[model samples]
Target: TLYAVGDWGQGKGKTWTRAGGVKLAKNGNAYTGTTTMTKGQAITARLIKVDANGKTTWDEIGDVKATADKTKTVDLKWTNAVEDTVDITINAAADLKTGETLYAVGDWGQGKGKTWTRAGGVKLARYGNAYTGTTKVGKGNAITFRLIKVDANGKTTWDSAKDRKSKADKTKALGVSWTSGKVNEDGTIPDDSAISISGKGVADGKLSIQKGNLAELYVIGTQDATPSDAVWWSDGAAVAVSGTGTVYGVQTGTAKVNVKVGNQTATITITITIK
Candidate 1:
């Protein structure tokens, strides 16, 4: 329900209330109105009483402007407007290139939440409901994502990722709000829910696979465990990856060994220190 009248110039206006205690104001070049009522009170404006069922509803009444004569009063009558909530969905894939915007939609009762997309993604959420945030991959050595939410007034907020148990745990926790796109208020990209590419490298700066001069691959993380059972590959003859982390190269030339982990791949160089 929208109305327009007069030559509503540009960028400069005042807001006020008028008629039937209908607080009105000129937002830039349009007339806006609001009411004061308890919950369950249907909003009545322009001969229409819109109900607020915990959802965002909106309808334009009409537009009015201040006459050049400086003698104009635009007043409207209706129900009050309260904050509502709605569900949103977002789906994004890894390896995303720039300029890819995430689509967001909500049931803004009336017709608000039209449609919006940000190339880098936007953060949104209800105060006590859920805190969520989103961002695109930026230029950084290691970048992490998290979801955050704020109140209707755009103040007071929370972050779901900050309270995550673990990277894997965050994945499961954030998958709930996962419609096709709307991720949970928590920032969690799981190996299964999301895509990932894991790569392996030998800091020794030598081709351990190519030379086949090595026995097998070991994952001596921060701990000094002889982690056996790791996959051992014969060679990259058929792009075969070591099931665990061990390999039996064919003592070949310089070859780069690699393994796949979900959406990521790991690679290692074998110099084949052939004696």
Candidate 2:
């Protein structure tokens, strides 16, 4: 639409006509002509209609009340001028279809197709067994772990899903895994690393007798210079040598060895007979 200064009383003719005047016609979606419109003037315009299939018609769609006189190109200078530019914004959850007229009026910058600046950042949270991170997530964002399932043994694997590679990026993440050897409920050596030794000469043997007896006490271990400590318990008392761990003495009957460290503990037994 276009407007002129002062009250262009001569409407619909010379003083006010379509885009190209009576001889020529406007082609675009919309066009208008206006005389100097004062603050109180009823600013109105006509809408060129179109059918569902794309048709134009000389029909009145909508209009807006112009702001005070001060809000204009030259203020009081040009009372009635066709406002050519107006700001506006169009938001659509889905794509825009046909025959959709998103319009605005009043002052400049009040038209469709205006862009807006969004504020704030995105958030993420866990939903059931899965997680959903929102777009625009912060760089150093973190979230707590919450488990909702327990194993058949009534034990929950909490803290097992902790992040391992501190330098890994979650955006382009490929995969994640963990490393933990399975252990028995009683904390015994897993069958995989268990040592099985049996023999009459080294196992079922006599250690002490009437001064003329010898016990073939079996000693099975690494010949490494650094010998692990040997821990042996007689009855209920704890006994040891240079170091109490997994070592044996010259003679021995049925003896129990208890080893403990950290959060793990193990015990072994050796048997012997008198000559």
Instruction: Report each candidate's C-alpha RMSD, comma-separated, in the order given.
Output: 27.4, 40.1
lDDT (C-alpha) at residue 271 in model 1: 56
lDDT of each: 0.30, 0.26
Model 1 whole-model lDDT (C-alpha atoms):
0.30
TM-score of each: 0.21, 0.17
Scored by lDDT, the top model is 1
Per-model clash counts, in order, read: 53, 24
Question: Which residue window of length 10 is worst by lDDT in model 1?
Answer: 164-173
User: Candidate 2 residues 1-275, lDDT tens each?
Assistant: 22222212233334323442222123233232223445544333333334566553443323323433322222111223333322111111111124222111111222334432112111122222212222322223332111122234544232233322211112211111112222121222234323221112222222222222222111122111111332223432222211222222325345554433323334445443333
Candidate achieving the largest TM-score:
1
Weakest 10 consecutive residues of candidate 2 by summed lDDT: 87-96
Q: For candidate 1, what is the TM-score?
A: 0.21
Model 2 misplaced regions, further than 4 Å: 1-246, 249-252
